[model samples]
Target: MASRAAAVALCCLLVLAGCADSPVPTDGADSPSATATPGSSTAIDAPPAATPKPDAVEVEVIDIVDGDTIDVRFPNGSKDTVRLLGVDTPEVHAENDPTEFPGVPDTDAGRNCLREWGERASQYAEDELAGETVTLSFDENEPRRGYYGRLLAYVHVDGDSFNYGLITKGLARRYDSSNFQYRERYGTAEGIARGTGTGLWGACATESPRTATETPIPAADGGPPLWVSEIHADAAGDDRENLNGEYVTFANAGEETLDLSGWTVSDEADHTYTFPEGTEIPPNGTLTLHTGSGEDGDGHLYWGEGSPVWNNGGDTVIVRNGSGETVIEREYGG
Candidate 1:
């Protein structure tokens, strides 16, 4: 009886020892603090990690420099000039390179047609990209740099090719280099625009060039001979610093080239400035008169001093031709 009792006591002690040796079941929350193992961590309930963004850089359009070129600001706060791949538009501004396309003839009539079409192309690009964010993609197989060190890229606006869109609209032609990857696609788009006679292809096809002797110039087709098209009296940034801000745009609505050498633009107080000698306003062309001073160039002239000639409150602008005849008068602000 004593041995049997001893054996039972030993069995009970062994069972209790085994229970203590085994790990205590824990819900982690109810357990005492413990050091985490090297390869393991506590399960965490958290939102899934965010997917990484693509490598393509995003930029804001500073300006639609033309149909093919754009000025952009990058994420790193750097500025660059980007030339679109596979497309070219008519030159709106003069080019430094003598080999550039759609060369305008020296004749006034030929220049007038070029100016009109160039303006349309510029306007079309501005309407689509001005102040918008776009993505710039480069060909991995081709040289990234283009003529003049401008970055050659495919500009995408909301995943649609901006270059391709322009070609389809007939505002641009397929101007592809051997390095261009989208040459075939762009060529096809140009064909569609040409076949349908879209935009410039159809609109300007039958238009005739005008000479200085041409009567009833483009703007006078049914409208006034000349008119004030745009006025920025308040300026875009600061009129105090950027005198060009307070300016007025005059468009020639007539078909004849007007020699504006002695023409005058005046304020209500006779603050008059005369167009310099050799100033010529072409048919359907525009001239901008800046209230601030700078060297004059094509399409723009300076008043040669600063201190706000145009009043933001109310102002009247009178434009007189060389003969002292008031051709256009405009009022604003009041």
Candidate 2:
């Protein structure tokens, strides 16, 4: 009896030991506490990473010149006129240059519309940016001077690009130069504004582009012997740096050979080049007047100006015959 009782006790002890070696099953979903690897997570509803802001310098905006230009004072107490990079705004007539807004039609209705939009754009710039402390970032590819010697920069207020904001509101268009930074972004913003018919895109009907042939040229008093054919304002390479590469071409449209001697090609700034004696243009032939220094060559005349005379933004080219009467008045750029 004792042996049989001992055997039963041994069997009970072995069964208890077997149970202790086995792992307990768990209802992982329902359980408040479950064994898991330390610091491991399921990552339910995690937030996305934040975008990095641009590297920039803090500057005080002294004046908002236009939608794309501002007078800014840097931290070092230096002030400069900074032209906003990657954007172009509608022209607002300055107090000094009342005719600065080029190509506005002579009609009262057209003039009124141009004035209204110009005011809106100017007001928006003043309201949002003038006298504000903002950040300025320059393009890595293009820094310092832009066209016309203005400091090129990207202005940011409260971490958002002010240049891009103008495009979003349709007050500006994407003007991509050779070293175009943020081209895709500015283009996308412009597309969105245009698609939604916002601001100028909706309000102005005359800003539509015209083909070269569609533009009309005024007839000269001598029955229009020649017409201004083409202009290369922004020349390619370091050649543009040299004043001579930029030129305006004139074509003799009449059948007769015309004497260009004593004729003048002048810009609004009064930079004029007088044709030398014995200079002539043959029928259906072209003559190029260069802005830089060069010896007089066939179909070419030099302006001999030390600095650029033509405004890259906008300018009027006035051509006159020997009598000093306006023969051809051509306007380009805005």
Candidate 3:
């Protein structure tokens, strides 16, 4: 009897061990902490949604002036007289304007030729600008809206620029200001146009002398002559490395030479650089002032024997002629 009881006890222990080894199911639910479900598809967290970018303003061209200036009709129904930021076109007199072609002959033939060239440039500009949309950017020096309340903008048409196009076609020359950001590209385009003898080159050829009597003249006392119209910072060559050593330039607007000996350059820092006794700028010329030592170029002025005015950061520059007259002033923020 004892042997039979012992055998039954061993059999019960074996059954209990088998039940413990088997996995038991709870109420029809999965484990709370489990990442994957048995026989179910693998789950993945959705990636965070990307942020959207802001929309850009749209611009359209309505009319063209030579290859540079344009009439752009803004979304607000106002007409904008848009000057191509980096280009200067040959002078074209308005209809019946007595003083239109200064320094150029007013003969019927010369006038007709000038008109034809202007028209041709305008035609080319129209072809490029018509029905085209562009992105417009502005320089800090330019008013958001011009004095006339017209929208002022530097246009980027297609991937290339219409401003550069003018220079490439010789319809325009580079017109840089201290605030212009696209200096290098404009300079290159102007150089190319000069070499090619395109629109303005052929139109204003020395062979055909045009009269200057009809050329427009600014008010005599008008704040500083137009020759000192635009100022620029020389950012080329080694000057690019030193910010403070940057130089400021003056451009002559008229077709004659300008004397700048009595001119003075100053900044907010109270630093003043007076022109040496023999400074002169030719027609449509450029005068540069650098920090370091160097001979003044044919159309440039070097300041500070060998050091630049501003170092490697940023500053403001003001140019004035004798008599405490202001020629040009610009606050640079590089």
Candidate 4:
């Protein structure tokens, strides 16, 4: 009887085991697929892939010079100036011409209005490119460097061409020259921007009431005894060929004749021109210095450089005393 009872118990246990739930179905995806391996975790989560960048050369921005110029450092640890390809901004310096910027009237107020627009464009570029890492694309046909030894390139910020953006916004024109590859596309974008009256196009539509004479150039304080009244950096022709065309005008505002013995005038590039021992300017008199070889006169002097001295782009005119003390420092834009 006990053996029969044990057999019955075993049969009941088998029946209960057979009645258990079947294995849940999973189409492989929902299943725990990790197979524990030696020296590896059973559950491994793969990291996400990183964002991809363009195949172009990358550069770190050192400075945003203006609307269309930049200073950059390459991966090889070299620094260079990059002039944005296929674009031209308004002149921020003293020189302004209505013919350069279309639709602006050829008047003092109109030029001043354009200058204001130029300042706005510069500010906008600063906002866009300040400390931004960018990529560079070259025009295969044109030379790598421009006349000023600045690299000619299309700056890519986040893969979009910043040069094109400038044209689309009317911050710049489609560059005066036709050397670049994207001239057609850039021209089209510029037309659209011009039609829509964007940026400079719309901002300078009307002439400002304030004339150029109304806004006299402010005197630069802390300069040498002589006051720098004017600077003509961009000459009429090729600056290298016409060195004497680029000159600086200084005035003696005092009542007595001033002696400038041992004073030196230097540019940002350290091209210095020293005043002669007997250099003197009479009361209420003026003097002009040219950047080429010439015979010195009562109020005229020369620097006698083989090439150009003052930077047409922009520069700081520094005047030092005989003892090498900085008596004058003046900075200006091109």
User: All candidates' lDDT scores?
Assistant: 0.61, 0.62, 0.50, 0.64
Model 1, total clashes? 5
Relative to the unseen true structure, what is the C-alpha lDDT of residue 326 in candidate 1, on a scale of 0 to 100?
71
Give the C-alpha miss distance for residue 97 in model 2, angstroms. 15
**Candidate 4 lDDT trough over 10 residues, lowest sum:** 41-50
* TM-score, every prediction: 0.42, 0.42, 0.40, 0.45
Candidate number achieving the greatest lDDT relative to the actual structure: 4
lDDT of 3 by residue, 1-107 (tens): 99998888666544432332234322111112212112211111010111111122345777775555677654544445666554555545564221233223556
Could you tell me the lDDT of residue 67 within candidate 2? 71
Candidate whose TM-score is highest: 4
The candidate 3 region of ten consecutive residues with least summed lDDT is: 41-50
Tens digits of per-residue lDDT, candidate 1, 105-135, equal 4455554554566677788779988889886
**Segments of candidate 2 deviating more than 4 angstroms:** 1-55, 94-112, 206-334
TM-score-wise, the better of 2 and 3 is 2
Candidate 2 lands at a TM-score of 0.42
TM-score rank, highest first? 4, 2, 1, 3
Candidate 1: the clashing residue pairs are 217-254, 217-255, 218-255, 219-253, 220-253
Q: Provide C-alpha RMSD values for all models, in order.
A: 27.1, 25.8, 27.4, 27.9
Cα RMSD for predicted model 3: 27.4
Q: Which stretches of candidate 4 lie over 4 Å from their true place?
A: 1-55, 206-334
